[model samples]
Target: MAILDNTSLQLPKENPGAEDFLPLLGTDHVELYVGNAKQAAHYYISAWGFQPLAYAGLETGLKDKVSYVLQQDKIRLVLTSPLRSGGPINKHIDAHGDGVKAIALWVDDATKSHHETTKRGADSYLEPKTLKDKDGEVVLSGIHTYGETVHIFVERSNYNGVFLPGYISWNPHYKAPEVGLKYIDHMVGNVGWNEMDKWCRFYEKVMGFAQLISFDDKDISTEYTALMSKVMSNGNGRIKFPINEPAEGRKKSQIEEYIEFYNGAGVQHMAMATDNIIETVTALKNRGIEFLTVPASYYEDVLDRVGEIDEDLMPLKELSILIDRDDEGYLLQIFTKPILDRPTMFIEIIQRKGAKSFGKGNFKALFEAIEREQESRGTL
Candidate 1:
C-alpha cells in the first residue's frame, strides 16, 4: 500500500502562528530500543503486518548495534538492539526496556532545524552529520525532549538509497501482507507528575508547535484512574504529540503505571490513521491483536449520543470500536492492549472523518475500558 495523502486534510482552526523556522514534513520513523531486534521484528511482521524494509547490523559493518526497519505505508518502525554488552543502546534497553528512543522527523534542512531549535533553547542530542552512500547523501541532526527520548531531524530529500547510508534494503523470503494502516495520526507521551505543561511549552518554544487542546483529569478519568493531557502540534499539523501526566486519583493512574514499568517518562501510544477502520481493525483482530474492549452497553445509545455517522452501528458494536463527535465531525477509534509484556507501550487505530479533535467525547468510556484491563493485570 502507498502512503496516505494528508496534504489536503484540515485540522480544527487554532491559529497558533505561522510556522517557518522549523518546518516538519512529517514523521520519518519511530525507533525503539529493544532487547532482541530479530524477535521484535518478527512480532511486528506477523502480528501488525509490517513489511521488513531495511536492516543494519554486523553484515552491514555495525558492530555495536543492530536495527531492523519495518514499513507499512508512511508508518516506519526501527527496532534496535545492542550487539555488545556495554554500549549505550544496551544501557537504554536496560533502563527503559523495549520503548521508544527517537521520534525521527522529516525536515527540509537538518542543519537549519538544529541551529534554529538550539537557538530557541533546545538541548542538542546530536550535531548535524551527513551520511553518504552511492545512491546519495542524507543530513541528520537531533535534539533532546522529555526523558531520554530524542527527536532526530532527517533531511533525506537528497538520499535515494534504502533508509540511511548504513542500512541495506531488506528483502526476506517471508513478508507479511500490510494492514490498512496508512500513517501515524499522533504519538502520546506519558510524563511525570505535573510535567505535561512543561513539555507542551517545550514543543511550542523549541519546535514551533501550537497547543491544539488541553484535557484535565476531570475530562479523561474513570472512577479509579486519572490523568491530564495537552496536545501539541507542529506548524503545518503534520505532527502531533499529546503530553500526559499522572493526576491525583483514587488508585494508580495509567501514566503512573507506565512511568513505573518503563522506569521513566516515555511514549504511551502511537495513534495510527486508517482509511477504513472496519477493515484495518478486522485484519488486526484476525491476526491475534488484542484490543481494549468497551462493554456492550456502550452501543445501546451511541447513535443518540454522537448523532448520525456514515458507518453502520452493527459492525462497530460487534468489533467493539468506539466513536466520538465534535463540532467539526465524528471519528472512529480503537486501542490495542499493550503490545509488549511490560504493559507500557500500545497502539491506537483512529479514523477521522472530518473531525480534528482527539476523540475527547469518548474519554470516559475509553478510560473505563483501560481501567478494566488494569484491574485484570493488578496494576490498578
Candidate 2:
C-alpha cells in the first residue's frame, strides 16, 4: 500500500548540490503556530485563498495539537495550535504571538543535514528520527533557530505518508480555490539587534549559504525606524532566506517589535510568488484579506521609477501595489498588516515579471508605511 496511492501531493523534484549548503531540495511545508488552528486555517483559506489540504487532530488521534494543512500550488502551510492550555504552544503564543514556527526544508538525507549542522554548532531541536504508519515512513530532524523557531529537515524520499505519519488525508467538505500562488520566493527572519551577521555566518559556515543581497541602514531606513538585511541563498538558488536585524535609529522598528513579541529572532513573513499580482491580490482582497494600505502619493512616481509595465497602473494605484524594476525585469509587491493581534507577523504578496531581486526601491516607502502602523499601535 503506497502512502500516495493516486490522490496525494506530488514529491519534490531533487536538485543535487555540493556538500556545502546542500542547495535546498525545496520547501517541504511551512508550519505556523497560531493561537487557534481552526481560526487560522479559516483565515488562510478565506483571506489568502489557500485550499485545505490535510489535517491532524483529535479525530486523527493527536491529543496535544491540531494541525490544518492548506495549499496553493507548491506552497503548503501547516497551521498547528495547542488543543489545551498551559503547554509549550501556549508559552510560545504568550511570548511571540502567532507566527511561523517551522520552515521545513525538503532534503534527500535528513541524518546528514542534522549531523552536519549539529557538528557546526547548530542547536539540536529533534534528533534524526523516522516516522511510519500504514501509509509510509518519513525520517525527520530539527534544529532550533532564533527564539522558539525551528528549521525542520524532512527527508521524504522514501516516505509517501499523507503529510507525515500521523496526518491523514484531509478531504474537507468546503474548498477554497487557489489564487495563482506558485511557490515561496523567500522566507525572511527577523533577529534581534546586531545579530543578522551572526546568523548569516551560521548559514555561510554551517549550511554553506552565500549572501545574495544586502541592505544597510541607509538603504532600508525610513523616517522613524530602520533595519538591515542580508539575503542568503543555497547553491541552486531554489531556497532563499533573508536575515534581518534592527539598526539603531530614531524610533523603534517593526523588527524590534517582532523580536520583543517573538522573544527573539524568528520568521517575520513568508514571501509567496504569484504570476499575476493584480489578479491574486484582487482575489485575496475580495476573499477578505486586508493588505496594508499605502498612500496614493506613493504611486505618483512609480511609473517614472519602474518604467512601463504591462499591468494597468490605475488598478495598481487603487490597490497600493508597489512596483520595482531591475536589470532583468520588474516585480509587483504588497504586504498585509499583522494577521495576528500582537503586531508580530505579516504576509508579503509578490509577483515577478522578470526580476529576481527583492524590491529594493520600495524598502523606504514600505518601512515608512510600517512606521505609520507602529505609530498607530504606539510601538514607536
Candidate 3:
C-alpha cells in the first residue's frame, strides 16, 4: 500500500553524504509471533477496526505456521503462530510471549540491501530469495538486528498479489469501519542494560541510519523511574526507530520490567498515525481499547507549554491525549496499555501536525502514568 499522503510528514533534510546504500521505500509490514494468530487477528479487527487482508497456513501448503494478515489503510500487520510444537517459531514463542519478530522494509533491491548490510557487519537472517505466483515476482532478503528482531528487505515493485505469493485473499464475514489509522509513524524497541548505544551504532554503521535525536535519562525521567532513548532514521526519514535502555533509578524502570517479563529485549510498542486523534481515539475506546491516562492536571498547563494548536483543549484533555511541539510543528499522541497480558507490547496512536520529532515533551507525564500502571501490576 502507498504511504499516507501528509505534507507534514515529509522527509527531513538528509545528512551530509550519509551512506544511502540501503534505500527504503517505506515500512512494508510488521510481523508478530503470536500465541494464536486467529484470536489475535480477531482482537485487532474487532477493537482496532483492521480489515482482514490475507491468510497463509496449512490450507495454503505451509505446514509449520499459520499467518493472518490484517490491513488498515497503509498499515499491514502479519500475525503468525506455529502450527505444531518444537521449532524456531516455538522457541521464539517460549522466549518472548507475543512480540514483533521482523520489521520489513519496502525496497527496490533486496539483494543490494542484504549485500550492503551483511558486508557492513549485520548478521544474515535470510539470503535473497525470489517468490512468485500468478500476480508477479518479489525478492526478499533479511538481516538480524538487536535481540531476535530482524529487518527483512522486500522488493515488491514487481508483485501484485494480496500480500505475497503464498497468501490468499482473506475476506471474512466480520468487518468493521476504518478507525482512521493511516500508517505507522514509528516503532520503539527496548534493549538490555547498556545495549542502547550498541544498537544505535549498528543502525548508523550497518543500516546507514542517522541519529535523528537522543534523550538522556534526565530528559525522560520521573521522580522514581528513568530510561534513555536515541532515535535512528533512515536516509529519507521514512523509517524511525527509537531504541531505549533502562537507567539507574530509585524504582524499577519500565524498560527493565519489559526486559524481565519479555525474557530479553524486544519491541516495546508500535506507534500508528491518524489524521484525527479525537475521532480515532473515540472509536477505539468505544470498541473496548484501554489507554494510559494522565491526570487532568496535565492539561491545565499544556497549552502554555505547547502553544496554540488546531485542536480544542477540552476534547484532547477529556480523551487524555498528549501534545508536544518541536521546531517544526506540534503533534497529538496517546498510548494504550499493553495489548497482551505480559505487559511487554503495546500500541501508540499519534497524529503529527508538522513535527518530525517524537513526543519528548510528554515523556514525564507519560512515564508517570506508566509507573502508576506498573505499581498496580506489582512490577514497579
Top candidate, metric lDDT: 3
Clashes per model (N, Cα, C within 3 A)? 0, 1, 0
lDDT (10s digit) by residue, model 3, range 166-247: 9999998989887999988899999989999999999999988888899999899999999999999887877889999999
User: 2 or 3: which has the higher lDDT?
Assistant: 3
Return the lDDT, model 1, position 245: 95
- TM-score of each candidate structure, all chains considered together: 0.96, 0.92, 0.96
Residue 173 deviation, candidate 3, in Å?
0.9
Better candidate by TM-score, 1 or 2: 1
Model 2 per-residue lDDT tens digits across residues 1-380: 11212222333432233234443567889998888899888888877778877899999998999999888878889999998988888888777778888899888788989998889889999999999988777889999876678899988866655678888788768777778888899999998877899998888778777788899999999777889999887776768899999998888889998887778778899899988888998998898777887788888888899999998899998888999999989999999988778887888999989897999999988888888888899998
In candidate 1, the residue pairs with backbone N, CA or C atoms under 3 Å apart (3 or more residues apart, or in different chains) clash, namely: none
Off by over 4 Å in 3: 1-17
Residue 125, candidate 3: how far off, in angstroms?
0.3
Displacement of the residue 328 alpha carbon in candidate 2, Å: 1.6
Tens digits of lDDT, candidate 1, 233-289: 886777999999999999998899899999999999999999999999999999999
Ranking by TM-score: 3, 1, 2
Predicted structure 2, TM vs. truth:
0.92
Please tell me which model should have the higher lDDT, number 1 or number 2: 1
Candidate 1: segments with Cα more than 4 A from true spot: 1-15
